[model samples]
Target: MKKIGIGICIGIMCFSSFFSYGNEQVLPHHHQIQKGSASYIETINQEKNRYVNYGDGYMIDYPSHMEVDTSLEAVRTLIKDQEREIEIYYDNFHNTPNSAPAYKNYSNAFIKNTKDHIKEYENTATINGMKVHLLKWSRKKLSKVSNDKNFYVSAEIVKNDKEVYTIFIKSSRQFYNFEDYMDVISSFKIIEKKGNPSINTKFKPVERKLNEETKEFYYKYFVNSDKLRWGIFEQSAPASFSYLKGIENRLDYEFKFLVRYQSLDVPMPLEELKNAYNNNRYVELTLQTMHMNEENESITYDILDGKYDDYFEEYAKKIKEFNHPILFRLNNEMNGDWCVYSSYYSSKDTNLYKEVWKYIYHVFEKNGVDNVLWVWNPHDLSFPNFKWNHYLTYYPGDEYVDIIGLTGYNTGNYYPGEIWRSFEEVYPHVYNEYMDIFEQPFMITEFGSNEIGGDKVKWIHEMFDYMYMHPFKNIKVAIWWNGIDWDPLRNPARIYRLDNREDVMDTFRQRLKDYK
Candidate 1:
């Protein structure tokens, strides 16, 4: 019966793509480019939506409000799980006229850089807009023999004089034609923002607090504080600067200062890390301690081995050198039987994990890593109290800790959206209680969605929406665990392949620039 049901699901999903890919284009008059930089003209005449405009193009419109970037040189918009991006580059043939042949030649090069899943798919009339040369293709097919394979993908490409664009949409093979029903793809348009854009217009930030009564999500209130609220979000280049401006407008506050992680490659000795923090580049130093001890060994033996202490001494010197606040999270998410640290410290042995936690904290203090702030982070549970005791069972002394953190990820067999919804239902207010007891800043140290669907763009938006509305006032930093072996469902060693998805990376990076 289960096998039959799974087969039926696969069949139905095959038709899912048409809904996102088969629509005609639509261009609004508001999106018209002002006659400047280059000649500008537009025409829109489709029953549903189809429009075309040409000039010094600056902005692009999408059929849906997706995670989008509308910078001038490059434009990208995500529709469901599909991503369409156009990057403009100068073509210097001097007098070489702009033609489809030249465009196809360049397109072929772009296609070559990608996997064989994409082939020259099709060329068709673009909704109500000018004719566009379109090519469609798919990624390597799924195999019945192995669990390791790149997630399936399909793509659409379009080219013109100013830029050459490609749309790479990813999904399981079950939803191969995902773009077929998407309204944005067939009916998208680009236009330029008008007027000499002003130089420095500082923004007023909007604040929001969690509204329990609503039950649903909202982002229009904040905990008013005498001291200005502080936050951290990363940025890239030109677009990143624009995103920063947008954040400033929404928050009405300049960052107190910036703290960049000096290095993520090799483990820093406690001494060197402290020095960097003391210099004031950033206050908090996050220590990853899972690899510091041996897994599957007696708790006493592990501690007496004195491995963790060696690293603590090295790390302490660095923390004291900078006089920086340290966010020390050791053996995070140990309730789950995944890592050597966590698996050995499961719910049954409360004393074991706690004793180890204390030993490390004591070593740090004794070695002068006192300037550091400690955080106790754990995984979210489906059955609230079933494993509730595991959360505080091994909690170390009050003198040794400052913050509590939680790691959450969506883990369903299929449907990323549904998986995310399940997580919210499983552990709704656990963090509020964590803060109440600890009375220190808390954080979602690691959070991400990894079920089955390909809608990474939507996943990011929903996550930010939740972060913007957590009830706890101290729920401060929310870092997406970008570490390679963090996925709970798959083999940890192979998780590195998942990070290769360029679309996922872009969406994640954009959130960092926007939310803080």
Candidate 2:
């Protein structure tokens, strides 16, 4: 039996060597040989036979069967790409069915410390009569142009104790049929060899590193201010104040301003908006809500034409007269595509959008409007793209903008603790990037989570907890999306009136105390 086995092995070696040379006959057309040819395969097989000298290890089995070229470079490249997907998978695994709080904390830390992109990884596994090792993972490209671009990764893990086989597959798609593949993956069984066992290592918790620039920003906005700490907004000024008075003991909240987005000709003209904002009653005021510009399209730039130009001038004059910190958010959420102003104005055409914002700022300056902190509020559409462009489209330059504000209200729409899909993710990344670019203060110009099961209190507390930790700098104000209509666009705002529900009062008071 031993002699027969030896003969068979020799025959296999000769057969492999015979075809491994420069033999185009064996090469497949349309498939260029990277490195592994017949000869290379023979050499690798030879190496495998001398397993007594090399160490053996174990890992999960490859779920699929595909040609795995034995080229070192190809294998290395494949392994380099899969590192992130693998890490994320592992994180999810450990976090779930484990400890939620610990997972959250650890995940945050891991995200902070992750510096390099995936380069490579290797692990061994054994299946039926074979030895498998997860040998490679690599990062193919950066997510620059396409968010949908697959994060390319490759895996070559051996399965079964007898086969000495490997499989390569995409990390993103590999785990889809997780249960079906689990049996194969679990078949990995490592064999002991002569080499000493290397140090056993596992993924560690990552530390959240605060950017130096961002740290300096917080110092300027939150810590530096004594009286003018936080800008507060509400639908009903009187009602909001009663809630404000309740929280006044704990927080130095600023009643920024209270005004409606309607025709400038109503009640007392645009000047009343400025006076209400400046009297120290509030620090910011959104002025004359002009008709949504559908024809020209760009929301920020679609001025109320020459007819309302005088009213706008008069509004500027009032701001100049009072000389108080008032935030002027002209046309907001223009990037949403739903709002008429955003639909028409948000365009790549430079003059198209800039011209409008420029006109507004230029007129305000011409009217000698100072003490007015111009806030450019963009709905947090999404990160890297949506909000960034829309918010910045009609920036009106540095001279005009004092604060960069983002509006994000929690509708009873989304699940609590669930990471928001579009705007939620956009908020952090956008805040970081914008601050890096503009170095100006950022605000949640408007943000509030609606009630679920009449649990608005819990919702508010949770949202506030998130902010208390990762506070945006230069955010002198935050307006709740609470109002009677509850329409996010028209009258989004918090019901902070003294006569309002005591629970509302309690929530505000607690948040103020926590902020302090």
Compare the candidates by TM-score and give the number of the best one. Answer: 2
Query: Candidate 2, after superposition: displacement of residue 153 in Å?
Result: 40
Query: Which tens-of-lDDT digit does each residue in 18-79 have in candidate 1?
Result: 11213644333222222221212122332232222232233223333222221121112222
Candidate 1 global CA lDDT score: 0.39
Quote the positional error of residue 86 for candidate 1 in Å: 66
TM-score of 1: 0.41
Error of 1 at 452 (Å): 3.0
Model 1: worst 10 consecutive residues (lDDT sum): 1-10
In model 1, what lDDT does residue 89 have?
A: 22
- Stretches of candidate 1 above 4 Å error? 1-267, 270-296, 304-315, 342-347, 382-389, 412-423, 469-472, 483-516
Q: What is the lDDT of residue 45 in candidate 1?
A: 39
